[model samples]
Target chain A: MQRNSKLSEMAEVKLLGVLPSPYVYRVIWALKLKGIPYEFVKENLSNKSPLLLKCNPVHKKIPVLVHGEKSVCESMIIVEYINEVWPQNPLLPNDLHERAVTRFWSKFADDKGSSVLKIFRTREDEMEQVKKEILEMLQAIEDHGLGDKKFFGGDQIGIADIAFGSVIHWLTVMEEGILGAKLLEAHKFPRLYSWLKNFQQAPVIKENLPDFEEAVAFYKGLREASLGRAASK
Target chain B: MQRNSKLSEMAEVKLLGVLPSPYVYRVIWALKLKGIPYEFVKENLSNKSPLLLKCNPVHKKIPVLVHGEKSVCESMIIVEYINEVWPQNPLLPNDLHERAVTRFWSKFADDKGSSVLKIFRTREDEMEQVKKEILEMLQAIEDHGLGDKKFFGGDQIGIADIAFGSVIHWLTVMEEGILGAKLLEAHKFPRLYSWLKNFQQAPVIKENLPDFEEAVAFYKGLREASLGRAASK
Candidate 1:
């Protein structure tokens, strides 16, 4: 077992992820935050790479982090591995309860925040339902997730912040695809909106974000294709 | 907060979960294994109770575990919370690497195991696709998840075991709901099938599982309702 300092230098870390997925971006941000150099292999979700299939055959999904030969799947689990492998900038809190709370919000973001995508492919009535869900999610996060703290886990940015940071930022860009604006409006969720701004300004996040124009264009194409399929049906 | 001993005695740890959901059963098995006394509040998912809504407004879903004023949502998160609040029979390994592996499989089970549900709801062609996914997931677990180890982590049943145990067991019942029998053929996935048998016999799991007849009847009702909805559409 390698210690933290040695693992950083010795481990050949590689990330297999797509370009635009917020889940993949969480791993990228964490690796960059820890100053761990890694080779990035972009995967086509339509035709996943053999390495991804081998590493995570259960899910056969991206954001699979390979350190040396050991592969870790699931976005947040990869982030947690990165935290343990290279403990320079800690991603989790020291207190057990605080850590649990951070994990609670992080898991919440991963599970519930997928509704943003649902808003994109859905029709008007379904989109309204998705909008209500987004508001309730944002409200829960605003009430239980953040207080006066700059990040989800006190002063420094941690895993929970990384989880939610990617979510709000990407969802904001996907707003054009939603067809109706409701939850992310500044008045309704002012603190989260401000947090979004603050989060994007962070150095690692700002440097690593996907090109905004391209992401919007991609989502637009996806929405069109989905609607086309529905119409044909 | 409260110390572990005090929590075990005074607090009532009630699990709010639906019968058909494997995710809910993960928490149930964990609580039972720990020898913690608790109440089970069975939820009618179609008409959610005020308590379920109040406890988990964010997702408004099971399985929510309520301990005093605190409520934890999401299945695996609730299991982890149970592990923390009751430290006697540890579900997760103490070693960092082993913990990461346990988490890796737990996440795998949560994300990939849903393919079984897809088979239950979809038409023949879509069911074939979902069956392919289910086979791949089962094979991966057989090859990578369990080797010489009796359980996922080691000799003792751990978090990964609890997570996948419910899925694999419930998948058998769900198979009766589906049109085909492709997931766990005795010839194809012998190791996984054997593991399933071993998992069922484990004392904690065997005692706490829902009655087999009831589960089959419940799934049959769900299957009929889903088919009816599809035909109506």
Candidate 2:
């Protein structure tokens, strides 16, 4: 896609990220939803760019969004920044209570949602514990995080949806490919199951996800390498 | 302070928390700074109040804020809710990029600041790692976070300050009283040391801090009980 000169005029927006990262996709989806034009730089995980290091010195992780000269690191923080900067199609709800609730879930995504990533690095006994935590995480969101709301922040695709959407989808892809078991089963989580349907079908998110097979293969290779390192240790 | 029904009409604000809790203090400082009136319900951490469990069923932790009928959990989140609900005295900076920067440091408090708490729980050998992390956390803020600016967000006291403040003070109280060491020395962290002085001198913060000697004694007793429990286990 050609750069929209009009959009770029406000500020130079750039994203530093690696492929097959739901965190990176969170930023991509938020930008696309808000209709903000940004250049995407694919970062090599092994050899991080000097710009990435300078932008996010504390964590040294991404996706870091450089808006003009200021850079915002962490996935959801970048989403919130995008929402605030480009307030056209509001990603967070307007109501103060709803905004706080959206942020609560967004924080939940970071605190609890990252537990699923342990599958990549855990031993057999630890993977069982990780899987249990994942189930409890899914159950909590299913029971308390969603109702018949269609999306987490109600009818609109809000920030919380963007936060958890990446986790739910990619978790499923990894579970299906590696474990050969359904972590997000319909019977286990009917509410979350339906939420998954409504969330992905949204035009913005639907178009932005990495290809299913490619992502699975990528995660498989990454997981094998991770476990292999664990074994060597 | 007595509850004013008139103030409650605008929003019936109630805080659920136990005394001597730094997490609880973050919300208290923000509310007091904003000059919002509210009733405080002291919770028993050993046996939590039903209201505490109900408002924050997910985390089941204290420092949950109830405004009218709505509730917000997580200390920083509650501070944010207080900022939004009562925007008279803003805790966050107004500039879009500055707000992102404020949130980045606030998140850093949770991600990095909590490592300092290990002194309360860990054995002597573990203290080295904990102190190393705390030093790095302080250095990150000194070397990169603060500059000639008085506060993390600039001249005025901001959200990031409040977030990091609770962690620093609590760690100091526990460290000084329990460990018998000064974790935040002026010679080591000149910028942060000046920040602590400026932060504590601010009327709202100065007035709200727990009685220092009393708090130290309380932490000393708690530490002995905690460490004794660990020994038995």
Candidate 3:
């Protein structure tokens, strides 16, 4: 077993992630927030690279972080590992209960937030259902997730904030692609909307987000391809 | 906010879970193994109970275990919460690295095992692709997950075992429902196959599992409903 501190300084930290995945973005935001220098390896999901397959053979998915020879898979797990190794800018609260609450919301973001994409890919009727779900998701976050705190963990951005930051940012792009409108209506979700502006303006997040026009264009192409496939079927 | 031992004797333990969900079965197995008595609250997914919605307002999903006043959502998170609260029968390893590895596999199982269900629900041509994914998932587990151990954490049924146990058992029932077989063949994945048998026969797991026939019938109904909806479009 490798000791936590025994990781070699000479060894490089390599992150395997695909563009546009919120899971991948969480890791990037964490690394950037902590000022950790790392090499980013872009993965093509269609033709997965050999290293990605070997590193994460079980899932063969991205957001695999390799520190020394040991590789950790799953986005949140990787973030946890990074927190333990870095320990400088803490992403999780020190208190166990607070940590548990943060983890609960983080897990919620992961398991539920993916449904936002259904709005873009499904039929018109199904899109309406997805819209309802998205509104409910935003409402829950607005009510419980942020109770007048600047971030999910209060003063500073923590794991839960990072988790939702990716969702809200990417959802804006997806909302534009699917509906030609923003879903995080500023008036309806005032706290969440304000937090979104604050979050994107944070130094690490501000520097790392993908170009708006490029992301919008990419999702537009994806939407067209999915619609074309649905039409043929 | 609640202290650990305050609710130990005075509080009641209640589990809110859907009948057919494998995620829910994991909590049942864990609680049963610890000899902790609890009340069961079955949830209707279509019309969620007020308690279910109130307890897990973030996700509003099943497998929410309410201990005293606090409710924990997400299956593995709930299992970990159960382990922390109960501690009589340890579900995770003692060593930190082993614990991390166990967690790694548990997360892997949660993320990747859904492909088996995809195989059951997909079109005939798509079944082949899903089958390939299922085989890859099984192969990775057999090679890296089992490795000459009686269970995932060696001689004990830890979190990884329980996570995968639900998945492997449900895959068997799904195969029977679909009237097709490919992945988890004894000759191909002997280690995982044997582990599956051992996991099913474990005393707590054996007693808590839902009837195989009932599970098969339920899955069949689900499969037909999904296909019917798809065909209607």
Query: TM-score: which candidate is best?
Result: 2
Candidate 1 per-residue C-alpha lDDT over A1-233 given as tens digits, one digit per residue, 9 for 90 to 100: 44343333466888998888888999999999999888999888888888988888766888898877677888888888788778898998875556777888988888888887775588765776877787788998877678777888987889998999877877877775445344577787777877787788888889988888888888888888888899899
Off by over 4 Å in 3: A1-11, A18-21, A42-49, A94-98, A115-133, A174-179, A211-233, B1-11, B18-21, B33-35, B42-49, B87-89, B94-101, B112-140, B174-183, B211-233
> For each candidate, what's the DockQ?
0.30, 0.59, 0.27
- The residue pairs found clashing in candidate 3 are none
Candidate 1 vs candidate 3, lDDT winner: 3
Stretches off by above 4 angstroms in model 1 are A1-10, A17-21, A35-54, A57-61, A87-89, A94-98, A114-149, A175-183, A210-233, B1-10, B18-21, B42-48, B117-133, B176-182, B224-233
lDDT, candidate 1, residue B156?
Answer: 84
Clashing pairs in 2: none
**Per-model TM-score of chain B:** 0.92, 0.94, 0.94
lDDT of every predicted structure (CA atoms): 0.81, 0.86, 0.83
User: Residue by residue across B105-200, what tens digits does model 1's lDDT show?
Assistant: 888888888887665577666676777788888888887888877788887888999989988887887776455354687777777777788889
lDDT-best of 2 and 3: 2
Q: What's model 2's lDDT at A144?
A: 85
Candidate 3: true interface contacts recovered: 0.23
lDDT of 3 by residue, B1-233 (tens): 56455445336889998897899998988888778899999889999999998887767888998878777788888887778777888998774446667888887788888886675578776777777777788888988898888899888898999999988998998888785664679998999999998999988888889899999999888888888888899
Candidates 1 and 3 compared: the better one by DockQ is 1
Predicted candidate 2 versus true structure: per-residue lDDT over B7-108, tens digit per residue:
332777899998788888999999999998889998888899888888898889988998877788999988888887777878888877788889999999
Q: Report clash pairs, candidate 1.
A: none
Flag the better candidate by TM-score, 1 or 2.
Answer: 2
Instruction: Point to the candidate with the largest DockQ.
Output: 2
Cα error of candidate 3 at position B2, Å: 8.5
Comparing candidate 1 with candidate 2, which one achieves the higher lDDT? 2
